[model samples]
Target: MVKKIEVEGYNALIECLKENNTGTVFVHFSGSLDENGVNWCPDCVKADPVIARNVDKAPEDSIFIHCHVGPKAYWKDQNNDFRQDPKFYLRCVPTLLRIGSPQRLQEDQCCSDDLVQMMLEETEENVTPRY
Candidate 1:
C-alpha cells in the first residue's frame, strides 16, 4: 500500500516535500473545495479515483502527496506559487510529478490507468524524468 499524505495550501505542501527528501515522492496538485465539499476542477475530480487505484504501484518506501490548491479563484491566479515555481511549472490542475524527477503526467494523461501505473513503477535505470 502507498503511504498517502494529503495536504492543503502551499506551505504544507512545501513542508511535506522537505520531509520526504529521499525515496520515491509522488506529488499530485489538485483543486480543493471549501466547507461545502465541492471541487473547483472537474478534471481533478476525474483523476482522483484513477490515482487512488494505482497508488499501490509506487516504488517501495515511496510517499504520495495530494496537494490541494484551494478554490478556483486562488488557482486561476497567474501568480500562484504552485504555478509560478519553475520546478513545478504547473499549468493545470491534476498534475502528477515525481519529486526531483522528470516523470510527470498532467491533464488528460492523469486519467489513464496504464500511464499512471507506469509512472508509479518507473525506476531510475528504466525511465528518466521528462523535465
Candidate 2:
C-alpha cells in the first residue's frame, strides 16, 4: 500500500524522506515552477535507505520517490515575485531531480508526465500489494 503524501518545497522533500516507512510511499513534487521556495515538480528521487534509503522503508526491496519541481517556487519570501539569488538555485531542485543542479535540471524533462510514467512503471512490474 502507498502511504504518505506531501506538498513540500525542496528542503521539505528531503526532510520528509528521512522519516521511516515500511510501505510503498508515493510523493507528488510540484513539476511546475512557482514563484517562490517550492519545487515539488522537478524530479523523482528513489532509493531504499538500506539498499538506497531513498525509496520505501520496506524490509529490503522497496520503492520510494523524492521529488522536486523547479527553483524559486511556492509563496515567495517578502513577496519578491519569486525572484531569488541564483546561488540558491543549487539549494533546491532547479528543474526536476537535479536538486542543487539547476542547469542540469533545466535540461531535464521533469514534469507531471514523468510522475505518471514512473507510477505507470511501478504499476506494471509492481509486486503484490499488501493492501
Candidate 3:
C-alpha cells in the first residue's frame, strides 16, 4: 500500500524529508488555492489522480508526499526557493521527483503512467548520480 503524506509549505516538507531520509520517497510540488479554494495550476490538478493511481508501484517501504507550494502569488515570486533551491529547483508545478535518485518527471511527463512507474521502480544501477 502507498503511504501518502500531505504538506502545505516548503519548510514542513523539508522537515518531513529529513526525518524520513532512508526509504524511497516520491515528492511532488503543486500550486495551492487561496481562501476561495481555487487551484492556480491546472496541470497540478490534472496530475493528482494519475499520481494516486501509480503510487502503488513504489517499493513497499516507500513514502509519497504531496506538497502544496502555496498560492500562485507565492510561487510566482521570482525569489521563491521553490524555484531557487538546488535540491528542488522546481521549474514547473506538478513536478515529480524521486528523492535521493535522479529520476524525475516534469510537466506533462508526470501524467505518463509508464514513466511514473519507472521512476518509482528505478533500481540502484539505473539511478545516475547527480554530482
* Candidate 3 lDDT tens digits, 1-131: 66789999899899988987877788988788768786789997788778778888888888899899987988889888788888887888889998766678887988888888888888666778787
Which candidate should be chosen as best, given TM-score against the real structure?
Answer: 1
Per-residue lDDT, model 1, residue 75, is 92
Off by over 4 Å in 2: 31-131
lDDT of 1 by residue, 1-131 (tens): 56899999888999888887777789988899767787779999899889888988998688999999887898999999998887788989899998787789998999999999999998867766464
TM-scores, one per candidate: 0.93, 0.30, 0.91
State each model's CA lDDT, in order: 0.88, 0.35, 0.84
Worst 10 residues of 2 by lDDT: 46-55
2 or 3, which is superior by lDDT?
3
Q: Mind giving the per-residue lDDT tens digits that candidate 2 earns over 17-96?
A: 56634443444333443566332332323211111232333223333343443343353344322224342333333232
Q: Residue 7 in model 2: shift from native, Å? A: 3.1
Q: Which ten residues in a row have the lowest lDDT in candidate 3?
A: 122-131
